[model samples]
Target: MLTEINFDGIVGPSHNYAGLSVGNLASTRNFGRTSRPRDAALQGLAKMRLCLDLGLAQGWFMPQDRPNQAWLGRMGTDMSLATAELRYAAMSASSMWAANAATVSPGADTADGLCHLTPANLVTMPHRSHEWTGTLAQLRLAFANSASFAVHEPVPAPFGDEGAANHMRLCSAHGQPGLEVFVYGLQGGSFPARQHRQASAAVARLHRLPAERTILTQQSEEAIAAGAFHNDVVAVANENVLFTHEQAFADREGLYAELREKLPQVVILEVPTSAVSLADAIASYLFNAQLVTRPGGGMALILPGEAKATPSVWNWLQTLLSGNGPIRELHVADLRESMANGGGPACLRLRVVADPATVDPRFLASADRITRVEEVVRKHWPEEIAPDDLARPGLWNAVASARMRLLDALGLAEL
Candidate 1:
């Protein structure tokens, strides 16, 4: 049966707070602090469990080979000789945000009747630019069922694409053909726009989505300036319900009109600035929550724990739940490590509509699988990584081997 599978990137052993992202408010705010990789990975695992308990299928991608030695070789220097900036970039665990791993167009929405996936060419950030190649490898391996899936290489760089983070689909159900929205940015003044309009348009072409069902919209510069680096930071859609902030798009009313024209059933739950300011929403990652359909009925908002702490955001959410809206449930996930680096519940997974059987079994999530992965994590992941520790060769070796051990445990040693 066709269903939605959320592929989460297992937090890597190299996970640290180097704060390499420029426009990410949390990344900069928590810069130069210590990071707990083991705890982070465990926290991610717990979040995945929450997903499973909610009757959603879950899958995972192993961490990329960090202190990306091969990348450094191309840069004409090994880890020992590279500059501090280069070293930090090479070892970054930013790939843990699998939402940027790729943009997936389900077979239901594609022209060829095969799910199409395009890994994002994250060229805008040094820590993330090198991620596409690694992410591509994982995507290919997981979706190797050629008859049912087509995984495309990222849009060639110079036109930056940040994958599913800037994409959303609205339909009556997961198996139905849907209206796909590609949100991009033209300018953000001081903060550079990461998702280029051309890149998003290119992805639509690559996926072969129908022109009538696709809406390429521009993100509001004001939202980007307020630290909404990716569209998912301000909005998320599951089926027909679009839970978003008021100032999320450049032409909010126009975009809504287009959406209604394309998919009249689209329920846009827009939170007003009066109730929750952009600052509060960005800080708590309110819209970064996964707006997923629950098993019994209705929908649930899986928000970060920080959202509950932000009074304005929490109050608004409470009011939302109290109303007769389609969103009737709420689940708070503790993701302090990820939140500190500016990723929330939505940032950690790539939503793909497909049968669980099509995915590589080793990557599928279950209670038993989580246990096995947890053992490897407990045994190998670093207890903590100080910013200065990233410069040490010992840390590099540990990070590399830890990932390999995870691969071995999962019978994916070839990766």
Candidate 2:
């Protein structure tokens, strides 16, 4: 049976409060504040351990090589001449949000019986644009068995991709053939629309997904304008259940009708507009919560602490829990460091549907490994980083040294 394994990105030593993301309110609001990279990495590691303790498969993706000298070289810019923004962009720990790692089509959904992965070319933001190459290399090394996996290079530029954060699969079971939903934003208004129709179509075609099982739906412009930079900010799916806001799509009725017609087993849970306004939805990030099937066969909503703080969302959540539904439980994870930068628990991971035995052992999580990672983070990670600190004289060496310690501890120094 295919298993959904969560590969969480280990927060990097360069994690800082730069407020680089344009549409993310939290990021903007928290700009110039002091960030605790140590706490951030520790919290992320704790979440991974929690998942593992709960009998879920957990893996890890390391941060991209920061203070990226190679990328700086391409622009003919060096530290001596680089501005604070330029340095921060290169050293951005944004790669800790691994949901944007790649678009994955499980073996069950492909024509060749091989799982396919395509690294995203996040051309929408300069800070994110340099991530694809490193992400591809990691995917290749992790899922390199050609007999069972196919990791494709990113789609050409001009066709921007934001990876699985904008895609979801709904199947009867993990091993079964599922329907793939590609959410594309037609317009961003003042903001940048990250996912492109051309890129989504290219990935679908490259994966050899059956035309009848694939669907492309346009994300509502209102959602994008309201800081739903990626579709996950407003909608998400797990198994056959789709949990979304009423304003999440361009044509909600048509999309549901199509899903019903094409995949009769699909179950949709749409939060009404009156219950929670789009603003609250984006602020609370209720849709970005992780919906996972528990060990007892019921599903739980693993929400961030922000959801509990929002009155409207909390009230709605209580009502949702009172009802007889598949989602019967809630688990709150305090990912405040990540949440401050517009990333919740869901944003920190990339899901891969595969058998645990099939994946590389090094990527897999265990109690011993988790403890070791935590120890390394505590020992070497920076306790506080501010925007101005990005340009500090020895900041690059400190970040590099801390990262090396983490890589060595995780046995991922080769990466």
Candidate 3:
């Protein structure tokens, strides 16, 4: 019963393009280091708007962060300027619906909540709660309730290095009757050299979730290739297990073909050829795809990638949602640098509960049709604030200025 869902976004800074960030193998600059201000602003704007739209449609969006931000910085990090970038994006998303009078609940009020994983906060492999405080605040405003924040315990050190933790992969939330499946790998430290038995034991105690739900896939010893793996087969939806074929690792053409052949029922998107390694491949998938299940259906399929090179995947998506399913596309030509920095549409958003009364169906259209929250402000505000204005200090200054202008234009008095 696995059903395919398609989601598409133009490559921009906001959408994390894993292919670009995986070690210059693909020859793209890191997003943070890009000199083009326009591209950055566009990517940022597109991503923030996209997150809002997707959150409205799916009722949830999860954003992950880790402590390795510092390490990544030292090791040539060029993606997000700060964890606050993600936070800011989430705030913009909720505020858009709120300002537009859309029916959307804040994360704080929902039974299911968004998880922000951070380093130093590790108790579980990915360190799932550094930004909990800020995340909670956004949820509260969106949902007006405190039920939204779910701070998972820190991932154990033995499970993986900071990179591995950041790459925490989502496995099938279904299967094994009441068990949640999660697959992660060990990237740095002695942990990768040792078997993850200790890490498994630690996860069992921390989350109170079953240990069987956790699957650890170790990095390969050879030249690291994207999506390469050994025997470690973990279920994704119900019966689908993601495995790596050796030949696929050796031959990109073969890997692409195999993915198409194996995932016919689902959409198989080839991460742009620009993408480099398994880690980048997985990150690209997590940052862009969503798990959408229709009411009454028990299975789901990962949506295919939208890059033109992956025509089969795109066609499959079009075919799947051709009829009744709602589809929205957002084009963010500006985020090229951000994707280079590492993050896609999903990484830039934080999902909250939905409010049926305020939800706008048009907002659910693809990126091309949906009006960006920033663009709305620019168009409706009484005064013009150039994108360069964002570079100034006093972060809320621009936001407050824009808000006042918007309210004035609407002829509404300040509350």
Candidate 4:
């Protein structure tokens, strides 16, 4: 049967606070702090376990080979002779945020009746620009069955694309045809707009989505200034329910009109600034929560622990729970390690609508598979990573070996 599957990226062994992200406030604020790689991976594993416990289908992506000597070689340097900036970029574990991995169109919504995926170029950030190649490789391997899935190359550069982080879909159910929404940003902001309008349009065209069912809206500069770097940082959607901050879109009312007209069952639960300011929302990553449909019937918000502690956010959440809203349950995760680097529950996974049996079994998550991955992490992932550690060859070797061991364990040694 067709269903929603969440493929979370296992936190990498080199996860550290080198402050490579330009507009990410948390990364900047936590710059130079020590990071616990083992704990971070285990925390992600626990979150995956939570999804499994909730009777959701789970899958995973292994960390990419790090101290990416290949990317550095193209830049005319290797790890040994690279500058601090280059080294930091090469060793970054930002891939742990799989939300940027790809934009997906389910078989139900695509013109060809096959699921389609396009990896994001992520050209806006130096640290993330090199991720598409690695991401595409894994995507092709996991969804290799030609009759079931079609994975496409990224939209060419000069037009930035941040993938599924800036995309959303609304439908009566996971298996049905849906209204796809593409959120883009314009120039002239304190922060660079990562998702270009042209890029969003290109992906829609590439996926062959019907024009009438697609909505392309601009993300508000107001939200960007407040550190809402990705649309998912301010808004998230599951089936027909949109859980968002009021200031998330430049023309939220117009967007909602189109959404409602196309799918009238749509329920937009917008939080107002009076109750929770954009600053509070972004700082707490309240909207970054995964608003997912529970296995039986209701909807649940998988939020970071930071949201539960923030007074304003928590207050509004209580109000939401007490009301007759679509979101019926609240689940909080201790993602301190990821939160420090500016990723919440939503950032760690890429969601796809498909038959679980159609996907490669090796990529699917089970308790036994998770236990094996966790064992490898415990054995090899570093205990702590200081900012200065990114420059050390010893750390690079460990990071590379840990990923190789994971790939071997999963029988994906070719990757």
Candidate 5:
């Protein structure tokens, strides 16, 4: 059975590298002139590398558009040249730049995939320029499972807005005979348009199939701007429809209560308050309420700020993967001045696939046990070089580069 899921791991400098920044760069809205360019480049490289690594480590294949690009040479063993090119094109287009340009494409392999496109609609127009590249990539990775794949089109306009899309709130799926949910933002003009009614209608229609349901929330006025409100929240899995009523922008406990009432059999946990941020909230909503499977075969309640607030989130994730289960997590960091402008971790990637058997649970387990990344190198790579060599940024890069060579020696392909 398929048992692993790919997720967007943390994006930031390599703790040892001083020049990398993770996430969307175009949406910072307040980037200064003095931002580090090298760091930005490194960050971008890291993000790209992560995609390639995930594909390799998990045996998952990425769809691409450009096979000639040297970056993808290492991936040839698994990914077809045609698929790689397609993915690259799609990712480049879904980047922050295209989101703002309001340009549309069918999405290429590497140069023109969902990473570069936005749903055509009103609610998403204002934030159209805001890119959620990273989040999309994560969603693609999650959906890359080797079971069933389906794309939900004409996603709700309101929910398709920049913020929601960045959080993967619109189109997301996982597992075989996959579960795909497409969100439509309420449209029809007038600030904070009453699109929920229309959105609800669309959702009902989307879930009309034999094994489908909808999820809705009553969000606060402030949160509503973020499109966090809905009337009835439903999730369909294993031919079961789970429903719940949520108060958007509610406190952690309030959110938990709603989830408990809707899916009482599942265990719910409130994310720590310290991790609360707009990005964290959106991710929590999507993962906890929408996608994650609870301890008891029901939806899990993940309060908005819990994942960021506590390291326990990682610990819990580790526990789940230890047994070959599918799970995903998102973490946000502040990157005000990096290449591409500025944004959180969710805005720099695009989706390409969501297959579980393709993923290796060991990677997730490694991520969970890793308290200090340096330890990863120590435990995984002890002979190539001494740990002190990685202390310097330039030296660290050299070490990283050399480590890549070691990976190649061990049959690890470069991307």
Candidate 6:
């Protein structure tokens, strides 16, 4: 049987406010503000623990070292040429959102009968563009069984790939073959369109997914302009249910018609424009939610704390919960640290479908591992980080030391 594993990235000590993502409203609004790395890490850990309590399979990815010297060398930039954005990009801890780590195809969906992973080439933003290499290395290390797993190089660039953030899968159960939906942005509008159609098609082909089981669609330009930087920002799916805003896609009606015709059992839980405007959805991150099958025999919605604060969102959620639908529970995870930077509960993890015993044991989480990770965050992580802190003479060393200490504690020092 296939189990859905959530591999969340540990927030690093180098976490700071850079406002690096263009279409992300929170990132822009919180730019240059003081950030509490310790608090951020703790918040993420708390969310993971909540998932554990819910009986969800959980794992973790280590943070990448900041002020990556090798990446700096690749850019050939010295201190003189380092602008604030450039410096922030070099030291960005955005890798903590592992949703952009890679596009995963479960063993059931691939032709080779092995799970496949393709690290995303996040070429849209300079800060994220440097993450693919390190992300790929970590992925390979965490999923090391060559006979059961195939971790591929990123699709060649010029075709920006944002990984699973723009992808969704729908199936009757974890072990069954599913319909893979690839969402791409045709226009950047005010921000860059990170995933290209060509890149999405390439990844689908690489997995050798049957054409009859795949769907490619364009994201709405209005959504991008309103800060829906990734498709997950406006849509989410679990099993046969797709929770999305009315304006999430360029051709919403047509897409729904096709989805219904193809999947037959597909349930499109679309939020009408009048009830919750597209702008309101983006502001509340209503679509950036984790839709999961509960152990109690029904579905649940895992939303960030911000959703509770938004009146429309909260009301709509209540309505959904009161109805005779698949979603029977509403969970609120306090992910303010991640939310302030344009991410939510769903952004913190990459979903992998496989047996826990089949994956690399080092990446799996247990009570002991969670306690150790909490200890590391509480003891070594910084209380606060400012925008200018990236330029401090010993900042790099400090961040690296913290990360190394955590890796050692987690027995993942090789990464």
Whole-model alpha-carbon lDDT for candidate 2: 0.89
Better of 1 and 4 by lDDT: 1
Please report the TM-score between candidate 5 and the true structure: 0.38
Order the numbered candidates by lDDT, best leading. 1, 4, 2, 6, 3, 5
Instruction: List TM-scores for all candidates, in order.
Output: 0.99, 0.98, 0.42, 0.99, 0.38, 0.98
What tens digits encode model 4's per-residue C-alpha lDDT throughout 275-381? 99999999999989988888898999999999999999999889989989888999999999999999999999999999988898999999999999999999999
Quote model 6's TM-score: 0.98
Clashing pairs for model 6 are: none
Candidate ranking (TM-score, best to worst): 1, 4, 2, 6, 3, 5
**Any idea what lDDT model 4 has?**
0.93
Clashes of 4: 0
Per-residue lDDT of candidate 3, residues 1-415 (tens digit): 1112122222211122212222222223332332332344444455444434444232221111222243345545422454444322322211111111111112221224322222122222111223333233333333332232233333445453121212222223221122222223333322232224344344434434434433333333331333222112111222223323232222435533443453333233232333333343443333233333334443233322322224433443455445443332323223344334333333333222333333223223334433443454344332322333323344234344444443343332221
**Poorest stretch of ten by lDDT in candidate 2:** 291-300
1-415, model 6: which lDDT tens digit per residue?
5789989989989998999988889999999899999999999988888888889999988899787777877778843467766788888999999999999989898888899899999998889999998999988988888877889999998999999999999888877888899999977576778899999999999988889889999999988988899999999998889999988999988888888887899899999888888888887888888888877678888889888899988999899888998889988988888898999988999999988887888889887788898998898898898877888857778888999999999788887
Worst 10 residues of 3 by lDDT: 94-103
Model 6: residue 106 alpha-carbon error in angstroms: 0.8
lDDT of the structure predicted as candidate 3: 0.30
Superposed Cα deviation of residue 242, candidate 6 (Å) = 0.5
Compared with the true structure, all predictions reach lDDT values of: 0.94, 0.89, 0.30, 0.93, 0.30, 0.88
TM-score of 4: 0.99
Clashing pairs in 1: none
